[model samples]
Target: MKKILRLTRHALLREQDAELRRIFGSDLEIIQVSETVPDVARVLAIIEEHRPDVVEVILPHSLTAALTRAGLVIPIIRAITRRVLHEDGTKDAPFSHYERIISLEIVSERL
Candidate 1:
């Protein structure tokens, strides 16, 4: 049996949320989180509760800083808005629509 990766997303709007669902499909168990910015405590609490394999946050600079300061070990992914495909239909791009802020292995090392 394949391992089910649990991913928690924070502050994603309707379109981004739909994109995530479309991209990840059933492979990931996606959890939606609406918390943002100064509410690091609430985000931390959600992390503790869900214990997700990965946490995806939109515009995460502040939250990332707080998580780092607090020494939380979960991996974080930063979701950014960008066209999924170019006008030429080429997939090569400087950055994906979303990017992982930290890798799971890196998080494990920190832990």
Candidate 2:
């Protein structure tokens, strides 16, 4: 069986589960985790323990740098979500646009 380690809590990646299953096989062991501000030791520990063939993660710059320094090359796949809202305070207007929220960056990344 193929083993996968999911390091984020977001459901966006679940949209590809069927395709992933088809590619990997019928049966898979998926381990899911959502960690905020994981230290280098903790990161390596989880990887060593799970020993997954695939790991889906979104880590902060510090953690990423630490991993890079620890001689690991990680591939990244980020889920980008867009919400369109009208300038007049409704989403139904013709001038619908996306507004950036500084607060959601951390929450989104963690998820």
TM-score on alpha carbons, each prediction: 0.50, 0.56
Query: Tens digit of lDDT per residue, candidate 1, span 30-110?
Result: 666554435678777777887776666553455566665666565566656445677888764233465655522223244
Candidate 2 global TM-score = 0.56
Error of 1 at 26 (Å): 5.6
lDDT of 2 by residue, 34-111 (tens): 776459788778878888776656577566555556654433233344566767887631212222112212223553
- Point out the worst 10-residue segment of candidate 1 by lDDT: 1-10
Best by TM-score: 2
lDDT of model 1 at residue 102?
51
List lDDT for all candidates, in order.
0.55, 0.58
Instruction: Look at candidate 2 and tell me the lDDT of residue 22.
Output: 60
After superposing candidate 1 on the true structure, give the runs of residues whose Cα lies further than 4 Å from its correct spot: 1-26, 83-95, 102-111
